[model samples]
Target chain A: MQLSNRLIKWLISGPPLVFLLIFFVAPSLIMIVTSFRLPGEFGGLAPLTIFSEHTSIDSGLTLETYQFFLSDWIYLEIFLKSFFIATLTTIICIAMAYPLALLIANSPRKFRNLMIMLVVLPFASNFLIRVYAWMIILGPESTLSHVINHILGVLGLEPVTLLFSPFAVLIGMVYVHLPFMILPLYTNLEKHDPILLDAAQDLGANRWQQFWCVTWPLSLPGIFSGSALVFIPVLGMFAIPDILGGTGDIMIGNLIKDQFLGTRDWPFGSTLSIMLTIAVLGATVFFTWLARSVMRSP
Target chain B: MKEIADIPEKTMRHSSPLLRLIAMLVYAFLYIPLCIVIVFSFNDSKLNAEWVGFTLHWYQTLWHDHEMLLAVRNSLFIACCASTSATILGTMAGLAIHRYKLKVLPILAFTPLAMPEILLGVSLLLFYLQVLNLTLGLLSIILAHTTFCIGFVAIIVRARLQGMDESIFEAARDLGATPWQAFYHVTLPLIKPAIIAGALMSFTLSIDDFVITFFTKGIGEPILPIQIYTMIKVAVTPEVNAISTLLMLLTLTLIILASRFDSSMLRDPSR
Candidate 1:
C-alpha cells in the first residue's frame, strides 16, 4: 500500500493544502490587503496614507483612515475597555471553573457524567438565545437583583447590583465559558496518580504547602490550556457584553464589530482587528514563554 | 502542574466542606440566570421579569409566529445539510491525512483551529461577496458551516481511526473483500461511534453558531440565533425566555447523545 515518497507526499498534502491556501490563507491575505486599502466613509477604493488632501489615493496612497482612528479618543477608549473586559471575563471563568473541576474529578461516575453533560449543554444553545436569556435576567425589572435583595434582606444586608455592569458581563462570561475552563482542568486533574498525593502527604508537607508545591505545579498544563480556551473566546466575545453590559463596558470585539457594521468604517475596523490579533498573539507568546521558563528553571 | 493536584491528597484526611460550598456557589452563579429565563418562559406578559402568572401562550405563539418559525426551519435545514456535508468531507480528509504521510497538510488543515473565528468570518464574507460576486442565503450559510464543522469531524474521526487495530481491515481484505467492502463492513462499523459523535457535534455547532453566521447570513434570512438576536435587541421578553428554555432542553438532549457516543468512540473502536 505504500506509494513512492514523492507521490505519497503529493497525495497526502497537496489537495488539502491547496484547498486551505485558496480559501483560508488567501482570504486572510486579501483581508490584510483590504485593510491597507484607503477607505471611504461611504464606499470607494483608494491607496492608504495620512494628511495630504492631495494624498487621498485615487490610484495613490493615503493614511487618513489610520490617522483618523489613531486620533479618535473613542476608538482608543473602546480598544482599552475591550481588553479590560476580556481579562475580567477570563478571571471570572477561572474562579468559577476550578472548584467545579475539582468536584467533578472526585465525584461518582454517574454524577460526573451528568455534570459534564450539564456543563456542555449550555454551549450548544444558540449564541443569540444564550444572550437573550441573560438579557431577561439582567433587564431593569429583572428578578435576579430582586431575589438577591430578598435573600440579603434576611441577613440584614443590601443586595448588590448584578445587572448591566461589567459585573454582569463577567457573570455572563463565567456562565457561558465555565465548561471550557472545567473540561481541560478536569482532564488534567483526572490524569493525576492517586498515590502521588498519598506519597506527598506521607512526606511532612503542610496542606497549603502541598497545594502550592505539588498540585498547582502538575495542574499548570490544565490551567494554561483552560486559560487559553476561555481567554481566546472571551476576547472575541460580542454577544454577551452587548446584551448584558451597560454603556461603560466594551471590548475589542465589540468595537471592531461596531466599526464595520454600525459605523461602516472598514479601514478603522481592520486596524482595530489587526491590533487585537497582535495583542492575542503577544499574550499567547508570553504565556508560552512563561510556561517554558517555569519548566526549565530547576 | 503537580501542586494543585497534590492539594486534595494532603487535605485527604479532612472533609472538603469549603470546596463543596464554593462548588455549590459557582453552580448557583451559573444556573440562576438560566432559572430566571426558564421561569419567565411561562409568563403571559411582554414584561419578562414582571410575570403575569403562567400561560402556555408563548408556546402557542411559537407555532403562530410565521417569521420566527421560518427562521427556525431555515436553521434546522441548514444545520442538517452542513453537518452531513462536513462529516463526509472531514472524514475523508481525516482518512487521507492519517492514512497517508501528509507532513505539511496537518498544519495547514488545523490552522483554522488557531485562527480566530472573527478573522475567518470576515475573510469568508469577503470571499463570497466581493470575489464570488454572489449574494447567498441558505446555501452560503451551509457552505460556511461545513468549512468549519469539517475540521471538528475530521479530528474526531481520525482519532477513532487511530484507535482501530488496522489488522481488521487486513483480515477483511484477506477474506476476499474488496478495498471498499473491507472499509464499509469492517472499518466503518468499527468507527461508528466516532462518526455519530462527529456528526452530532457538527450539528450542535451549526445550530449554535453566531460569529460566522453573522457575517455570511444574508438579509431577511434569519436563522434561530439571528431571530433571537433581533428580538433581544428590541427588548427582552418572556417569549424570548421561552425560546431560550426550549433551546436549553434541545441542546442538553443533543449534548447527552453526542457525549454518550463519544465515550464509546474513544474506548471501543478496536472492539
Candidate 2:
C-alpha cells in the first residue's frame, strides 16, 4: 500500500473522511478547547464562546482547572481503583480463559463454535446491560446469593454479602470481559497441533508441566491480546462501579464523567482522561514488548 | 517451542479434579446471574428477588410501555441505518484502498477505532451540543455510531477483499472489460463474504452500543441499556428482567440468522 495520486480513489474515500472530519474530529477539537475552560467565581463553567462570551476573553485559559485534578486525593484514589479493577479482571480472565479455551479446542467441532458463541453472545449487548444483570444477581438476598447460601446452610454457614463489594465488582468485570479473553486464547490454542499434546504425554510430562512449559507459552499471543482488550476498557468502566459498587465503588471513569457532565469541570476531566489514555497506551506497549521478547526466545 | 507433548495417566491423579472444579465454578460465575435474570422476569412481585408467584405481568408491562417502544424503535432505526451506511462506505473504502493503492488513508481511517468509546462520546457530545447547537437525539446517535462502525466494516471487508485471487480481476480487465465492468463481473462477487460479514459485525456493534450512545443521546428514554442503567438506580424490577430476557433472546436470534447468511457465493444468484 503505497500512497498514490488518483482522483477516483480520493472521490471514493471523500465521503467517510469528510463526515468523520466534520463530526468526529471537529467535535473532538472543540472538546479540547472546552477542556481548557476555567471556572468562574460562581462555580459555573466559564463558557468558551467566540462571540458574546469573548468580551471577557481573558477570563478563559487557566491551568487551575487541570490543577484541581492533580491536587484532588479522591480523583487520584478513583484512578487507582480503575487500575486495580482492570488488573484483577485481566488476571481472572486469563486464569479462566486458558482452561476453557483449551477444553473448547479439544472438544468436537460443532460444540466448539457453539461454546465460543455462548461466551461471546453475552458481549453482543450494550456492555452496560450485563452490568445491570450483575447488580440484580449479586445483591444481598439476591437470588444467586440466596441459592448459594441455601446450599452452604447444609453445612450451617451463614449467608454472605457478595454484592456491592470489590468482590462483586471483580465478578462483574471478569464475567463481562471473559469472552474477550476466551476468543483470543481459542484462536491461538485452536492452531495448536493435537499431536503435540499426545507427544508431550508420551514424554511423561504431567498435565500441569505441559501447560506451564508449552500451552501457556504458545497461547501468549492470545493471552496478550485478550488481556489487553479486557484490561483497557475495565480501566475506565463507570457503569459497573455505579450499579454494583453502589455508593462505595466509584472509579476514575465516574470521576471524569462527573467533572464534565456533572460538575462542569472540563479541565480536570480532560487531564484525568489524558492520564487514563496514557496509562492504557503504556501498559499495552509494555505487554506487547513482553510478548515480542517471549516470541524471540531460543 | 517444545518437542514433548502428551500427558501420562499417573499425572491425572492430582490435577484433573482441580481443573474441573475451577471450570465449573467459573462457568457458574458467568451464567448464574443470567439464570436469575431469566427467572425473575417471570416473578409476580415488584421486587426482583421476591417471587410471589409466577407471572407474565412484567412482560405485559414492558409491552404496554410507550417509552420502551420508542427507545426500541429509535435504537433499531439507528443501528440499521448506521450499519447500512457504514457497510457501503466500508466496502468502498476496503476496495479503494486495496484495489487502488491508497496511502496514509489506512492509518487515518482506523485511528477513530483506537479512541476509547467514552472520549468519542464526549467529543461528539460537545460537537452536537456546543458547536452545532443541535439537540441530542437519534440523529446524533446514528452519526456517532457510524464513525466507529466504519472500523468494523473496513476490517472485515479488507479481510475478504485480500482473500480474493488478484488474478481474476486482472483477467477480467485484460479481457477488454472496463474497470467498472471488471469490478462488477469479478471483484464484487469475490469479496461479498467480507462485505456481508462486515455489515453484520457493524450492525451488532451498533445495536449493542452503549458507550457512544450514552454521550450522544439527547432525548427521553434513550436506548434500552441506558434505560436499564437508570432502572438499576431505582430498584431492580421483574419488568427490567423481562426486558433484558427479551433483548438477550432477540440478540441470539439475530446472530443465528446472520450466521445462516455466510455463503461465499453471492454473485451466482443461482447458488
Q: Using DockQ, give the best candidate's number.
A: 1
Each candidate's interface RMSD (Å, one decimal) is: 4.8, 6.1
RMSD for each of the candidates: 4.9, 5.0
Per-model B-chain TM-score: 0.87, 0.83
TM-score of chain B for predicted candidate 1: 0.87
DockQ score, prediction 2: 0.35
User: In candidate 2 chain A, what residue range of length 10 has the lowest lDDT sum?
Assistant: A1-10
When summed lDDT is taken over every stretch of 10 residues in candidate 2 chain B, the lowest stretch is B262-271
**In model 1 chain A, where is the ten-residue run with the lowest total lDDT?**
A43-52
What value does the lDDT take at residue A100 in candidate 1? 75
Query: How many residue pairs in model 2 have overlapping backbones?
Result: 10
Candidate 2, residue A269: Cα displacement in angstroms equals 2.1
Give residue A58's error in model 2 in angstroms. Answer: 5.1
lDDT of 1 at A145: 68
